[model samples]
Target: MSLRGPGGERSRWRWLRGLRARLALAISVILVAALGTAFVATYRGTGTQVRNQIDEDLRTDAQLVDSRLPLLRAKPGEIAEAAEEYLDERALFPLSARLFMVRIRGAGNISNLPDLSTAEGDPRLDRDVAGPRRESDESRALRTADLGFSTVRVNDEPLRLYFVQVTRGGRAVAEIGVGESAASVARAQSGVARTFLVAGTVTLLAAIALGFAFATRLSRPLRRMAGTAARVSAGDLSQRIGSTGPQDEVRVLADAFDRMLDRLENAFARQRGFVADASHELRTPLTVIRGQLEVLARQTDVTPDDVRHVDEVVRTEVVRMERLVEDLLLLARADEGELVRPAPLDLAPFVTELFDALTLTADRTFELSDVPPGRLLADEDRIAQVVRNLARNAVEHTGPGGLVRLTVRSLGQGRLEFALEDDGPGIPEEQRDRVFDRFHRTDTARARRTGGAGLGLAIARAIVEAHGGRIYADSSPEGGARVAFALPGFRAAGKRAAKEQAAKS
Candidate 1:
């Protein structure tokens, strides 16, 4: 439920939870992985091709050396001279120089060709010529060592070497190695690696940024929908999420939710209006009935039994009509928002007066405690009526000789609290909330016996809330029901001292 900040621990992995981000990440990983794989494969294959070319050159050089070996053996001193002429005529391509090394089969027969004595040359050839000789039998059929192409240093410059051997009729004759500088190859490979790294880094960063943007786009509509849902749950049925773009699934869902809210708001409005109209319509008839009953009760020459029976019926009907009229008026006033007026008045005197009046009407003893003279900005009459109704309800439900207590206290700030407790069976947990609803009754038989209506608590709630307060019913610490209400308080103006006031006057 708490908000998160970017760069926090959870932020790093936030993208993984979002659908758009996950899809973008999946695409980016596949692209980079495939590209990196292809790059490596191509680079390695090109390197192998270059090396193979060098090997082919080495093989050809070995064959050429073998073909000229008879000529060299017939003229031993002229071998180096012939090698120089051959390299200058055939191997001296642009930026290319072929160096040769020749060694015999003797114990110390290592030798560099006489014409190849310059230090500004391939070191790879010198390395192959100067290193210990390979076993004579291991030489390839063309009398070549088949030394694969490789990079090396020559006079402080990188170079490539290709080595070949010479044999005469199954006996090792000599070794010949050739080499060329490889500065271009090294530069080319370094450029390839750098290019791959730069492109990959830029691509990955762009993918992450784009993924975040898309995720925000997708989450925006959902966040608005969530806000609308919260408002609706809080009883604000006027709110709704507006649709966006075309009629996709999200838009369809939003439209449905808006329609539902509209229905609820209309239903509540109609229900409130009906209650108000019905209460007004029933009041005129009840008034006429009560007046007729009053006239009948005053009739003369009536027998005592007949009088008693007629009086009981009249009283019962009066009580029933009065209860109905009171409930209807409460519902009407609640709908019209006219039940309470905000004003600064003391509540202790009001509660005390109400308890005194109810005590005379009920048999149960009423105890009052902690009745602080707190000032409140509420309708004093409505709050008193609420207190009276709750007291009467408690007294009717309490057993004979049971106790009813009223308590009032300041709740600090601008709030005041009042609670009425009784020694009676508490409301069931499941029915506690429903007890405030209109026409809800827990004891239908008891209500009939006592000539009680079920609208007392419901009316009390409407009146309390109309005063900008709230009421609730819960189990009391006295093993009975406790009904409580809280209202905003106001401070009374202090009285001026008479002496100071006289001086000013």
Candidate 2:
């Protein structure tokens, strides 16, 4: 139910557990929440504004009754008879308003809405609010605060009441109450609620559908990547994918995946080559040993010198086999790509010692240049081995008296480039790129003369890469082979050593 994020944290949404589902749900939640909030705010605001308008109309009706009563008191013998005709002569009120009256001279009353309380004793009105009935024209007006405003109901619908009390000689003569219809306020509020419900439902459905489609589209590249990964796991590294959807993170990821596949394909090819070349190289020596042993077993009078010569030959082949096995083991380990542990080493003396040792092993005109004065961080043995292999490779390819130069120089990017340059026929252009490939040789004749299964350059390349450096072959200025490798320079090594020492402390 929980999805893992890029950082490996469990996702917060429990029900919407997948990444796409959560994305869709999140967008939908925001949309629905926004719509619901707007609906409630607008509905409440509309109800409040309409109710205020209705109250204002009720106030105006009460004021009209007050104006009509004063003239009636001066017009006739009784306030009731003249007020009745005056009420009939005028327009009733707006559809929202109704009229109610009480004669203070006696307990008589009339109302446009019969539901109105009369003489303050009508059963429909609350006894506590209505109080005792008015018995005479001298009935004192109710308290000033309670005189003009009240609440009532008719046919179960709520109403607002505003009363105007009339008096003669400062004694109460009559009272008029104006009630306005609050029913329309309820109806307007209902209409708004219904409209919001319908609109919100439709909008929510649309938002959910769009969110699902958007999530699907965004996840398409990821789904394709997953499929490709499954195929890769099943041993098919040749499958490739690129910028599947939009030019975004997914596209960038697809490009990177393709680069990774390229590397995998090359590594796997090297692995296959390693196995095949090892088998072929080992078979020849074993076959020679077996044939020589068989011939010696049939000899009748083998001399001590002959036996010693046979032993020497067998020993030489055994040593060669041992070296081949060791080199293969090293290459196998390199394939795992573990870190290279480098320490501070002086290149000046290191290169001098290396040249002196290599010249002793091969007959060639060796030129040693002054090594630059700076210590670099390198696995001293591995660096020396890489140089030794290149020198040996140069020795094998060049004729007798051929010149070979061992030089050290700066590469301007905190790198020191050490190269073995030979003054012999250089490698052809087509073979340059494959020079570092395992078991690669320009031709079978050269491979046999060199007595190399074509692993020296491959081993050198692997060691160079392990040091976070690069190795390559090029034509020197003298038109001969230039096999070089560059590692991190001395300045960076000192800084790195200092930081490591500080961390330990």
Best by TM-score: 2
lDDT of 2 by residue, 286-309 (tens): 987898898799999998988898
Q: Write the per-residue lDDT of candidate 1 for residues 108-200, one digit (tens) a residue.
A: 222233322322234433423533434222121112324555566655666566665565555555556665555555556667778778887
Q: TM-scores, in order shown?
A: 0.44, 0.72
lDDT of 1 at 488: 68
Q: How high is the lDDT of residue 173 in model 2?
A: 74
Cα-based lDDT at residue 187, candidate 2: 88
What's the residue-level lDDT of 333 in candidate 2?
83
Off by over 4 Å in 1: 1-32, 53-81, 84-98, 106-159, 181-185, 263-505
